[model samples]
Target: MGEFDLIARYFTRPVRRAALGVGDDCALLSVTPGMQLAVSSDMLVEGRHFFADVDPAHLGHKALAVNLSDLAACGARPLAFTLALALPRVDAPWLQAFADGLLRLADAHQCELVGGDTTQGPLNLCVTVFGEVPTGQALLRSGARVGDDIYVSGTPGEARLALDALRGRLALPPAALQQLRPRLEQPTPRVALGLALRGVASSAIDVSDGLLGDLGHILKASGVGACVDATVATNLLAASAQQAVATADFGAQTLMQCALAGGDDYELVFTAPPAQQAAVQAAAQASGTRATRIGRVEPAPGLRVVDGQGQPVAQHFASFDHFA
Candidate 1:
């Protein structure tokens, strides 16, 4: 099929939330009064972001999901998104499945697909998502303060565990791999939790590039240090995955590494003051997402990981950096 035909057949739809959708040169969006536009873009290249044989549907869900994660971190509600896709060749089944997954998630969050471009090239998907939050109410990395309790939403590290298993860096049973695959392939963007955190979280960020690394952005911006309880953080791994790791002969340190440095989690690692601790839990409960307190912000400046006994754990875990 031709370019326009491909787009119409797969990606095009009647946009309920956008001013103008496909067939326009530019999509128009109207921001609510007293609200600011929150925009984020994410790109996924075939080999770098996903395996060659990955399900197209999952790819579609993730392409937009990652960008939504950015909005979630900012405490914005997703409004719409534009997709730019490059394909090596037109594969009807692949496009159909991809569009299905992409639009499904979009519909779930009331995020409309408004406009985009399709081109000939290696398979690549880029999504630019738009969201809105009340002026001056958007969560930011610079808002963290000393004594703020560090919290993370949902489970982290399962995605990295899945990746390690797939890459042969670690051994896991087939059942374990099957169970963990969804964590890596299809991450749920914490939009509700973010919305709930509007005035609750002091500083917020999505845990895309490992928990520690993403949390570091908040630390640097807020000019504060943190002491994470390693035991708490490591135990944040889902129970099944923890059992799998143990069965595979990996120890607590390895689990700590995965839980701390595992990227692609797409969960939120945020901060809130001690006084707001009750409010934070209320937010979590309202959103029906589990939020765990793993650490606290300190007046000093760097990230410190400590064991249950308050003894420091010696280790270095780096987050993902495209250029580094």
Candidate 2:
């Protein structure tokens, strides 16, 4: 169908949170009183971000999920979002599935679809999400301090493991691949954990890049260092990854690679002083998401990794960089 028909058929909806929504040239948003707005935008292009054969519904979920992941990092409550999609051609089935997935997650988070544009071009989905956090309570990457404990919610690295398997770079059993595929295709954005950590977490960020790389953002922002006990890398592996290494030699090293450098795990990495350890755990329990203490923020200005035996392990893994 035509552009307006395409948008109306798949995307237009009544706004619950927006002051003005889809039909207008610009949607208006109002943040809760005593709260500040948090906004983030992300773009996903075919091939670079996802394979052409990926499920369209999941693609719709991810397109918005990644952006919501940003709001999660800021400990904000999602309010609304705008979607700008580029299409190679009009396919009703694909659009329907995509809209279903996107709207489902939006509804789950109470995030309304506000306004956006559609164009005939290569497949690309851009979403700008809006959220809000109480004044002076927003978690930031710059708040980490020495002696604070570093924690990650849920798990990390399974997505990269699945990607490697799908790319033929690694050979995994069909069952293992099947188990890991969803981690790569559909990621969970940790909203409740973020909201729970608001005043408890000294610093926070979501692990979109590899753990080290994304954690590095907090370190740099806070002008501190981190000492990660490599023993915890074992805990960061998803069940699928753990199973993949069960009988394999050099499993420890393999698991560490996935944990340290594998990106696309949308879990949260956060820090809090020693005193807040209990509160952090309480937040995790309240959110029903797992949280693990893997390291400590240090006074130094660089990152260091150490094995369980207290021996230092050199780290050189880099995170994903689209242009790099």
Candidate 3:
């Protein structure tokens, strides 16, 4: 199939939320009068983002999901997205599965696929997602303040554990691999949880790179320090990471590294004032996602990890950097 044929056959859909969808020179979006548009774009290259042999369906899901994660960080409800795809060849089955995966999540979030371009080139997928937040209510990393409680939605180390297993850096039991494969291939974006956190969370960020790394963005933006409870790190690992330590004999510290420094969790790391702790819990329960309290914002000016004994731990780990 050709470029236009590929788009029309696989991506084109009737207009739903957008004023104009596919086939138009530009997608016209009508932002709610009292809402501000929150937009983010993420690009997934074949090797950097996923393996060349990765399933196209999973790729499709992740291509858009990552962008949605950004909106989630800002406590925005997804509205629509544009997909720019570069493909070496048009494979019908591949395209069909990819579209199914992409549209499934889009439909779930009520996010529309509006318009994009498809061209022949190296395998690359870029998605620009637009969402809406109530005026003056969008969550910002700069909103964090001293004495805010730190929380993270769901587990963050599973995807990293899967990647480590695939790379032979760690060993996983058969059962563990089965459970972790999906976390690595297809991440669930926390859109509902983000929406639920609109007022409850003082500052929010999606855990795309690593918890500390991404949380650092909030700290730097807010100009506030944070104290991470090292003891809480182990409790946040997924069963896969736990199993890696359980049956594979990996050290507890190793699992902590996975939870703290490894990325690809796509969960939310947010902060709320101590007074809003109960509300944060309520939001997590409403969203059907588990939010774990892991740390607290401090009056100091730098990030620090504190041991169970309340002593500062000396360590360093960098998050995923594209050019690193």
Best by lDDT: 1
Over 299-319, each residue of candidate 2 has an lDDT whose tens digit, in order, gives 988989888887997756778
Off by over 4 Å in 1: 243-246
Candidate 1 residue lDDT tens string, 40-125 = 99999988999989998999999999999999999999999999998999999999999999999999999999999999999988
Of the two candidates 2 and 3, the one with more favorable lDDT, higher being better, is 3
Query: In candidate 3, what residue range of length 10 has the lowest lDDT sum?
Result: 238-247
lDDT of each: 0.91, 0.88, 0.89
Query: How large is the C-alpha RMSD of every model relative to the true structure?
Result: 1.3, 1.5, 1.4
User: Candidates' TM-scores?
Assistant: 0.97, 0.96, 0.97
- Full candidate order by lDDT, most accurate first: 1, 3, 2
lDDT score, candidate 3, position 192 = 90
Pairs in clash, predicted candidate 1: none
Model 3, runs deviating above 4 Å: 238-240, 243-246
Estimate the lDDT of model 3. 0.89
